[model samples]
Target chain A: MFEKYFVFSPYFWLVLFFFIPLAIIFKISISVSEWGMPPYQDIFLFDNGFKINTTFENYVYIFSDYYYIGSFVNSLILALISTFFCLLIGFPLAFYIATSNIRLRNILLVLVVIPFWSSFLLRVYAWKIILQNNGILNVILLNLGITSEPLQLLYNQYAVIMGIVYTYLPLMILPLYGYLNKFDLNLIEASKDLGLNRFKTFFKVILPLSVPGIVAGSLLVFIPVVGEFIIPEMLGGSDRLYYGKILWEEFFVNRNWPGASALAFSGIIILVLPIVIFQILYSRWSQKNEI
Target chain B: MKSSLIKSTVIFLGLFFLYFPILVLIFYSFNENKRVMVWKGFSLRWYNELFNNEQIIEAFIISIKIAALSATFATILGVMIGYSLVRIRKIPFKSFYIFLSSTPLVLPELILGLSMLLFFISLNNVIGFPSSRGQLTIFISHVTFCIAFVAIIIQARLTDFNKNIEEAAMDLGYNYTKVLYKITLPIILPSIIAGWLLAFTISLDDLVVASFTTGPGANTLPIVVFSKVRLGLSPEVNALSAILMFALIIIGLFYFYFNKKFKH
Candidate 1:
């Protein structure tokens, strides 16, 4: 009897709050736009003989516009580049930390994730301060004689990427460390004893084993970076646009609710839905194996 | 010796990259200059201004209120979901249940915010409840996303512990509910607190979802801080960053303490 209460209470809350909201986005996406209070015509009409009012024009408009498509592609490219850099920097750190003495390993792991505990927006803002023309970075560069004049480091794609890789690096590192920590050091020795050099051993033994960590960390960084709003807003320039900004502008600036809904719904379908389905299928497969 | 040198360098550079911006923020929070980038001399002027500022204080209070309330609610519901997923076998449409709970973990905040704002508007249109968005709306949305975080934490904790204790309690004289209240809840209490802290921080730190759901007089700390620093930097904000970072890091350490305490 109490079991039903446990199952049903949360189940009801999720359906009401979580699931319905998503369904609402889809509904609004399919509805026709209008210049009105709500900004979109109701999908169901009762005034005239029972009629359903819906249009796919919003989806068509979004896909047809280079402005929207270009920004999305820009975001994807940004996510890819950031994920690559994160992996580049994060892999070695996770590997070394995993290989450290047990006490040192715990300390390093905590140290790695500490910066992440700080406010994300503040952390991004920290980059803004650093990338300022007279910022510490410029001061160092000039004093070191790397450049005579201070470089314009703030408000560009590179600055955006830098902020992202900084903020999201911890996400990548934690997962990579989780997988790498489980790895056997003996495997590396075995490969070495078999006459495999460093590169060969990394590719043959280490890299293959750490694939799950790579995938998890990459996805963790990549997906959020695609939809990231603040880092770009604070650090980015007009040189590039991203999906998050476009979606924000579509609703708030253009006052195009349907357009924004369509964009968001498209994001859900293209980016989120496939991964969720795969996760569901994968978990089921694993559970079956366990049984 | 050579490989160890290489390892130390890699770790040093990696940590430096992670911490450089943070150190810069803290270092500049003490600058006496009105212009944030200019370092005239070290002083505590901005911290003084930050405390005196009403907007920041009010927003901070509102943020704490929402975070605490939402974290509490999310923890309760999350415990239920986590318990259900682990212990219950008769869940109807288990896949759909899992989908509802887990999707928020991966869903981008922008999309989630949009869907929620739209949902509130539609609900008001049909039901005439939540006539306007404000703290209530923000609280609801925070709780929704936060549930997944708390659930994941609780689920892991529940899974790791031995189930034999609960069985033993039941096999003795204790009833099902008695066994849960006595044995299971006590075992996972540390995780429960850890999950609450995680939820609290996530809610407090949120910007996008709060931005979407917030209304007049409901500006969160992030909203206030973002508004201050959007076009340009503010020294008062610099001071706020210093304090907020310290407080949040403490919360994070506490979370780690509670989370790891019962693991062994």
Candidate 2:
């Protein structure tokens, strides 16, 4: 009887707040837009008796417009590049940390992830200080005579990618470390003993084994980066658009409630629904292994 | 020799890349110059100004209040979800339930924030109780998402917990509630604390969600900071970053300590 409370309490909260909110997003996405307060017509109407009003036009609008689709494409490309760079930088670090003696592993792992504790806005702000024309990086480059003039580096896609890689590195590293730490270090030794060189051993043995970690880490970084707003907003200039920025503008700047809802619901279908399914299945697998 | 040197160098470089920007942020915080990038004689100049700034101080207090309240709510609800998932066998639509609890973990904050804002508006249209968006709206949104984070931690901790203790307690004739309070609760207390701390940090650090849900007089520290530095930079923010980062990093350490302690 008491266990029912434990189950139902969170269930009720999630349903009312989480599940219903998502349904509401779907509801508004399909609702007809109008020029009034709340901006979208209610699904049910009683003007004459009863009527249902909803449209797929928001979907059509978002799909047909290149601006919306292009921003989404930009976001996908950005997420891919960011995830790749994160894997490149994070792999060796995670592998090395996982290989560290047990005593040092925890400390190194904690140190690497501690940055996540601080304000994300501030961490991105730190980059602004570094990339400014008069900032330390430029100062050093100028003093070294690397460039005759201070290079403009503050806002652009490159800066956006750099910021994403820097911030999301830990998300990549943590999962990789989790996966890497579980495998036997002796596997490497065994591969070497079989007359395999370092490259072959790594590719044949280590790489194949760490795919779960790589996928987990990449998804962890990739999914969020696809809808990332802050990094691009602060570090990125007006060179490109992203899904996050567009969704933000549609509602806040452009005041298109139904349109924004459509974008969000579409985002759920496009970027989120698949990942959520995979995560559910993955968690089940992990729990079974845990038991 | 070459291998060991290479290993140490890569590790060193990785740490440097991670810590350098933070060090620079802190290093510049103490500069007396109004220009943030230019280094000058060291002083507590920005820190003093930060303390004097009414807007930031108020925002800090508000952020703390919301974080604390929402964290408490999230912890309670999270503990329940964690316990239910691990112990209860008869949950209907178990996969759907699991999906609900975990989707927030990966869903983009931008979409989450928009969904939440839309929900609030529709709720107000039908109910009209909230009247307008403010701390309450932010609090609800915070608790909703924070629950997922707390649930995950609590779930991981509970799964690793020794089931024998609960069994022994049940064998000794204690009721379910008594066993939970006396044994399970005590055992998982550290993780509950850890969950709370993680939730607290998340609420505090959130910028995107808070921005979406925020309204008049509800500007969180992140929202305020973003408004100031979104297009350009703010020197006061540099100082605030140093202070806030130090404070939050300590909280992070505590979270790690408590969460990690139970893995033993």
Candidate 3:
């Protein structure tokens, strides 16, 4: 009886709060937009006669607009470049940490990920101070005579990418370390003994084995970075707009409820839904392998 | 010897990249200069200002209250979900259960915030409840996202340990509730604490979701901090970041200690 209660209570809460909210997004996404207090007409209405009204105008509106489409493309490019840099930097660190003596490995791994514990907004804010015109980096440059004056550093897309990589680096490293830690160091020795050069040995052995880690880390960084708003808003200039910024603008800046809902729903459909299905299938496969 | 030298250099560089900004933030928090960029003799001017700033203090209080409450609630429900997933096999719509519990981990915060906001509006319209969005809405939102985090940690811990302990307790004639309360939960208590810490930090750190669901008087610390720093950096915020980052990093170390997952 108690066990059943344990399951049912949480089950009910998730369905009501989590599942229903997602359904509501889908519902409002399909609703008609109008000029009003709520800015979207109700789907269910009964006045002189019972009636149900909905429209796909929001979806069409977003698809047709170059501004919305372009912002999403920009986010994708940003995510791609950031994920690449994260992998470039993170892979080596994760590899070295995973290869360390077990005791040292544990300590190093903790050090790598502990920064994630700090506030995300503060981590990004820290970059703002560092990238300031007369900030430490510029001060060092001036002292070293690298540049005659401070370069504009803070409010640009490059700064956005730098902040993303700096913050999301740990996310990439942790998962890669998880998979890398499981492999035996002897594999490298075995590949070398087979007369393969270091490059060939790595490509033939270590790289193949760590594909799952690479994929996991890439998805972990890529998916969130695509939707990330804070980094771009805090660190970026108006030179570029991202999906997250556009979505925020639609809702809070412009107060377009249905349009915002549509954008969010489309994001789920385009970016999230397929991943959810893929993850479900992947878990099942992993479970079968475990069994 | 050469390869080892390369490895050490890579590790040191990576750590420097990771820690450089944090050290800068901490260093500047004590700078006496009113201009945040300029370094002067170290003074505690900003720390004094941070404590006296009523906006930040009130926001900090609200954030702590929300994070603690939501973390506790999320842990309870999350422990249940984790337990159900690992031990109980007869869950109806098990796939749906997995989907609901895990999707929040990956879903963008912006999308999640919008969905929750729309749901609350829809609820208020049809049911005439939650007439205003404030702490209650934010708390619910936090718990909803946080459950997945706690659940994942608990699930990992439960899966790693032997189930024979529970079986032995049952053989000794303890009821299901008694075994869970006395045996299973005790063994997983560290993980539960770890999960709660993770959830607490996540709730306290949230800005996007809270911004969407927040109403008058519900300004969380992150929201308040973001508004202050979004336009430009503030010295008061620098002081707050140093203090908060230190506190949070300590909690993280405690989490690693309790979970013991950091060990080889």
Q: Pick the candidate with the highest DockQ.
A: 2
lDDT of 1 by residue, A125-236 (tens): 9999999999999999999999999999999999999999999999999999999999999999999999999999999999999999999999999999999999899999
Q: Which residue runs of candidate 1 sit more than 4 Å off their true CA positions?
A: none
> What local distance difference test score does each model get?
0.94, 0.92, 0.93
How far residue A278's Cα lies from its native spot in candidate 3, in Å, is: 1.7
Report, to 2 decimal places, the DockQ of model 3.
0.86
Off by over 4 Å in 2: A282-291
- Model 3 misplaced regions, further than 4 Å: A289-291, B261-264
If the candidates were sorted by their DockQ against the true structure, best first, what order would they fall in? 2, 3, 1
Best by TM-score: 1
- lDDT measured at residue B205 in model 1 versus the true structure, 0 to 100: 96
Q: For candidate 2, give the lDDT of residue B224.
A: 89
lDDT value, residue A174 of candidate 3? 88
lDDT of 1 by residue, B1-264 (tens): 999999999999988888888889999999999999998999999999989999999999999999999999999999999999888888999999999999999899999999899999889988998899999999999999999999999888888889888888888889888878889998899999999999999999999999999988899999999998887899999999999999999998998899989856
lDDT of 2 by residue, B179-231 (tens): 99999989999999999999999999899889888888998999989999988
Best by lDDT: 1
Total clashing pairs for each candidate: 0, 0, 0
**Per-model TM-score of chain A alone?**
0.99, 0.96, 0.96
